[model samples]
Target chain A: MTTVISPPESPAGSPAPRASRGFTFPTRFLPVIATIALFIAMFGVGSFRYEGFSSPQTLLSVLVDNSHLIVLAVGMTFVILTGGIDLSVGSVVALSTMIAAETLRAGWAAPLVIVTVLLTGSVLGLLMGLVIHYFEIQPFIVTLAGMFLARGLCYVISLESIPIKNETFTSFASGTIEIGDYFITPSVIVALVVLVIAAVVLHMTRFGRTVYAVGGSEQSALLMGLAVARTKVGVYVISGFCSALAGLLFSIYTLSGYNLGAVGMELDAIAAVVIGGTLLTGGSGLVLGSAVGVLVLGLIQSFISFDGTLSSWWTKITIGVLLLVFVLIQRLFTRRTT
Target chain B: MRDLGLRFVRHNLFWPTLALVLLLLLNLTKTPDFFSLRLQDGHLYGSLIDILRNSAPTLLIALGMTLVIATRGIDLSVGAVAAISGAVACTYMAGSPDESTAGRAVIGMTMAVAVAVLLGVWNGFLVSVLGIQPIIATLVLMTAGRGLAMLITDGQITTVNNSLFAKVSTGFVLGLPIAILIALAVFAITAVLTRRTALGMLIEAVGINPEASRLAGVRARTITWTVYVFVAFCAGIAGLMIASNTSAADANAAGLFIELDAILAVVIGGTSLAGGRFSLTGTLIGAMFIQTLATTIPTMGIPAETNYLFKAVVVIVVCLLQSPKARAVLSVRRSSPLLTKGSAA
Candidate 1:
């Protein structure tokens, strides 16, 4: 049984024109361009309306605050490109944080803890991929089960938060590289490094092309001799690894691991990915676009904060509205193309 | 006799019923009084009764969910819709000077349901009209509905101390909880409404193949839109019931994760997520199974915090068992030896 990767069929037997060119870039770049435009518009509004919002330090603070989200969205972009989703990422993040904090508290070496958590994340992703691939279960259900398993594991580790006291972790949290008036933390640096690697891999690697092919049409991918199964599984593994890395950064940023941390973060990652111009049906997207999506979300939060009279829940409402608009845009484009 | 028994075992409802029975038996083993019901005044009291009462909200939501799923659409926003319903109802009631009146309660409930219906229409429009994917379409509300709820409550847990409102959930009717009675009424109406008309068949056809069904003059858009509205209405009532049960509506926590439970109930009831033929009876059994599981977890001495782990394992097992791959292996093993005997004939 095919699960979660069913592309919207063309209206009739006649397929839509697959090759299309816009004025400059390909037609597929429309959504990503729109996302960038939205980000810029929001940034302009913030700069115009709020006194200090346009300052580089304010922009840097947005990055610092949402570095973990940026990493999560990058991972999510990969999965969505394969016409799959990884709902377990948020739970995996919480589980990773709990494991890191507990291990650090037990005086384990920081490097060892980091490696173990990353491996654990990859293994968890591998398990889910096996079940989803071999069993032909829906990715939604499989990742949902993974979500529960990870969240439950978090509770089993400790119902309460565990504070990290390791010197290395503390130093990492405190360490920052200055650039003029703005400073960038280790977490931000890690996030940027991950973004660069993801962009390169997704844009330049054969495996990346395979992911797009599989998402475009699994049957065609198989006929073309691409390793569809491996590509599908690999995307989830990447997501898991990224979630764990993000979790480690989060724990460092907070200096504690709480079971409640990162609740609904998977949704945020999804929102960022979609807002960044990734299609939920998969096939076409950009990692850099997802990074822009993260910034848009961070900017929304920053704007809400700047508007002291507004409730924080407005951030959620705005994201929801933006997600709807993006989805609508996607639908219109698909309708027009098909 | 053997043939009859085998057919029964092979029936779709068999496994879920057996699971529910096993859960009840486990409860009985722990506390013999689990099965014993007693009449107190006009109402019944027992573990079984409690399960029935507690499962009312889920059952109501699942009743609507089964229909939605049958049409190959999922309503992920049910929980959030429920939250919004509760927030609207409670805030309306709380704002009233005389909140205890039956008329005010009716007005509040009507307003909440009206809003929910509108939300449902929006979901339907996105899916059927706009041709957006159901998961993503419903997700818009699933993400923002709670925020809307928080806005309605002004980011506070709105509480109402209305006797009439409280009675909607806690009061008894003919020796049973009103909530249970309402759920049963809804179930009966749904069963009659689907089976007694062509609605059920059309819905199934649409779910099986929307384009083919549309070409067959099934009015797929209308059917899809109706089910979304119905599910939202049910969620609204459930939201009201839950809010009345606590006499408070906490937007953040109200109806949280309930959509998952409702979906699980539908799955457990043997409804395929891929959509096609659906069983409302099976959904009822599945809802009961989940409620019993919830009740059993705490009674079995599992710590409250780690209960979700056990639940996760059980859900996986149930889902795996229903998976075609698992069934294929089991059926292959069972029929392999019999194949030779059959071929000899």
Candidate 2:
């Protein structure tokens, strides 16, 4: 957050103190300010039109319905922070969901089913990381291939939608703890828990520091003796695990798995991560910022649905615009900070 | 002669050709008619020709993409640009239903190409002037360009009734399909433009080190902008060819994953993702390789639904071979045998 200004390399006749007085502001507070401004604008618009837009139930529902996406965005923030992207998350979600639903249909135990799904996602991510690291291939191409392979595997498992008949998933999905007239879904709790854990891991752990260091500069990180390849590979593995977890949550929420599910969800996650003030170039972002971004996007969708006139295509357009705006802001911020 | 043979063995073409041979040998074992060529309706038809025809659009796009990639920049909007061009051409042709054949077709083609060039210029301005990242800059158009295309056609597929338009894809010229001829023409133009001029040198220099090139007065910004615009224009031409082939312009589906296909072709053609080098001839071969693999999969009785998977595998393998480590291992394998024999003797 501290801005250290260097004196301009000019003749001594030029202004002295003024040259050193560069504009200084805290970087960490920018997202918070933007979040507050967006919240105020949304509240004002909702109050002007919708009757129950400010109601606790409506807000809770918005958060609950989009919790799975929020989880995906959280994971994507980590990957994007390291200046890498995971385009396979959407397909991985579908594949993982398919695996879980198929396991449940085959009468596998719920605990084992969950572990298998998570492991499958991690293994896939590990393979991608190994290929990318050992072979020195670009992450984009590797992940793109991952996208196709995962989606194809989903179809190979079953082209038809597989319904989850397990009572465990149903209960976890539908059951909610009530607080007077407002209720909190289990998925929302999971999303919040994951966000908190991610924040802790990113800010407090050695591996997190290595991740930031790697993204900041791979050469510098390597020179600093950081495990660059391991860190890079680890982040992707974490992303894969997070995607698998999101898939499990999605199946719980939907009670079915279809190969066609989550076809374009990776773009949404990328948009969310970008809008959260994360640099696509890598090395600076907050998991909590991504959570806020997911909420902002969810609110936009909620407002659009409330209006009842706008088509769903507007969602893609709005996200595109927001992505552009945030990217411009990040560019300006980086220019100033450096 | 010995030196020439060693040079040939060491060239990158040697390995790709070896791979191609292996693939062909594998295919011949399963399907004896895989290499059979025949003439039908005054046109040469065979698996090879079919692959070349099918890969025409991708080859054209990849030719442009190779230049863009050589500058260490990517244009994700190529697919969208193609879609927009298709929409413009189809919409214009549909609107001027009663106009003279030559006038309407010529006007429509010109308009489509102009629009694509304009869009490319816009992208170049953002990337080179505004100093935006190539991916983010192209993404803006990638998202909006599709909408603009849909808006032009009212989100409907427009089928063309123009014979001249269809000829671009279906007609034959001098015993060769017009599509193949167009592809060949594009390849020749690009090859001459890059190899016979200083333009290619300047592009490679700028890509290797932009700031250094600027210090050396290479006009890096202008070069970068020019390549993106050129790439977009090429994509536009490809769009027209695809739409003409299908005889229907479905803006949404016309070029959905073409960007990926183009990127794959460029990578397979031995271009480095990190920039500073390129190969137009290699891209042409790569395009044909992809098209042949795609066609062969279905022909060999594999389920059609697995095409995406098969394509993914091929791309992964090709990419792996291009990786620095893979090349290192290959060289080591070729040399280690000599070292072992010398020690044993």
Candidate 3:
């Protein structure tokens, strides 16, 4: 997370190490470690309690079930890394899902359906970015408006759930690549591929560095000659693409689209991102960490369901507790650093 | 005289007033009785009164929001805090019934206020002392506070059979809704406290330049912390009013999206999201404007679901108008010598 450490400053004449070696571990790594530990612990407990919990079916189901969320989180990570947010992602997902499902129902080719949904999402996000960056409006406000606009459009298209009657979508959704009794679903593979691509973009590119620089200090980044506006717009566009992709993936899984399908899913994505150690203040986070965060949340829900007594509300409660704890920890880490 | 009139037209208040007027005009075209007023049961009854009554919670929240935003901070937890407060207040009222139980209501309120205050302080501590981003800090509470509220009520809506509690929201004092009076009182108090003391100046200074404020020994941390606590308190009050109005504590639905509405009102009132300056009166007007729009839509036979869409459009327009670039453009247009040349020549 802090791999590109700032050059150390020496008060005295002595030169300091270019990268400080104290503790060596980045502060952001704490949440990532915690998430992994939690994932392992939950898996261990689930396997112990339920015979099939550790089986390939359970693993595939969990991954396939939450692939859409994973996609959304990947997109959210980019936007958050740029020190902005996209509250409209959930609404965008709904709108995109509706468009995709309707297109498929209308006998459009799968490629056309995909392209239309993605372009629509990107255009909406680009407009939002233009308004926010050019007009100097708050990202929260602009995205809030986007949320309403997208959701309204979804409603306008059809308030009722539009079922995907296309055989291609159903086949793709149910299709599995079997490998000696361990099957991998397409959605899971797609999510994994997206995660890898996102991680690479975030860690290895000049654009990634620019994102961090802008988030860390916009003024300093401007002074350092970073393309602040373009980077900002890029992040939102990436988020929009991710949301659109997630929407399409979700429609495949659910076989239907409705205006209220992903209501408050943005909150869940945000919670996962934070729990995964992505600082909302930006400048640092890991895509892998977010992937694990989504798994951890999925595991919590699975555990709750396994218990049979606890209602689904417990999921929200658990997430809330984790969010508060992570945030407080983030506060402490930031305090010690600055 | 014409030049002076033009300057007045270009004032900050001009846009909000014009927007309000335009909205009102639109309403008038749809509903001829938009301007009709009556006194019913010693209470002023009209669209204006309805606007004020409906706007009470939003006005209170936005009033608090203005201060927090003045410090260049946002409180996403206000809605959650309100939910928590409602849960606490109603749950306590359900547990007791005597006049002395009203004291329990007070205690419950106090406890809810304390919890809300602690949450705010926690947010303040992060933003001021720990340097955590305001959005992240408050988001923590925003997620957890609602769960805590649900947990407090055991994830169920608790119905209260308390008269005093109902009266707090439902009763009339001199024909005005008790909620309206409470809202007015809260507004008056916040206005006086902010304007009459060094709090407002310190808050603006901290928001404008925290480093400079700290260097000047302005106790930026304390000021930030105080405003958060104050904001949470206002949210708590709003919670009580809502719970009392329904006579039931709905942990799930109470004050849902209220934070967004409050933020909208604050923005519409011309408070910069980037912070430093705020207007309580402007926030009140902004809150009323939203309520008016909502009330007007249904009165004009627009479907209720369309309210969200309309509000989104209105909020976007308001945000655009208040944006720094838009303001800069407007200022340039107003100050450009072309108009002077066109007039003088």
Of the true interface contacts, each candidate retains a share of: 0.56, 0.40, 0.53
Chain B TM-scores of the candidates? 0.96, 0.91, 0.90
Candidate 1 local lDDT, B82-193, one digit each (tens):
9999999999999999887888999998999899999999998988888888889998999899899999999999999888888878989889999989999999999998
All models, DockQ values?
Answer: 0.66, 0.49, 0.52
Poorest stretch of ten by lDDT in candidate 3 chain B: B93-102
Q: Candidate 1 on A209-263: residue-level lDDT in tens?
A: 9989888888789888999889999998999999999999999999998988898
TM-score of 3: 0.89
Error of 1 at B260 (Å): 0.4
Worst 10 residues of 3 chain A by lDDT: A15-24
If both were scored by lDDT, which would come out higher, candidate 1 or candidate 3?
1
C-alpha RMSD between model 1 and the true structure: 3.5
Between candidates 1 and 2, the one scoring higher on TM-score is 1
- Give the alpha carbon lDDT tens digit for every residue of B7-108 in model 2: 998786666566667776767878798788888877888777777677888988898899999998888888889998988998999888563386787788
Q: What docking class should model 1 receive?
A: medium
- For candidate 2, what is the lDDT? 0.83
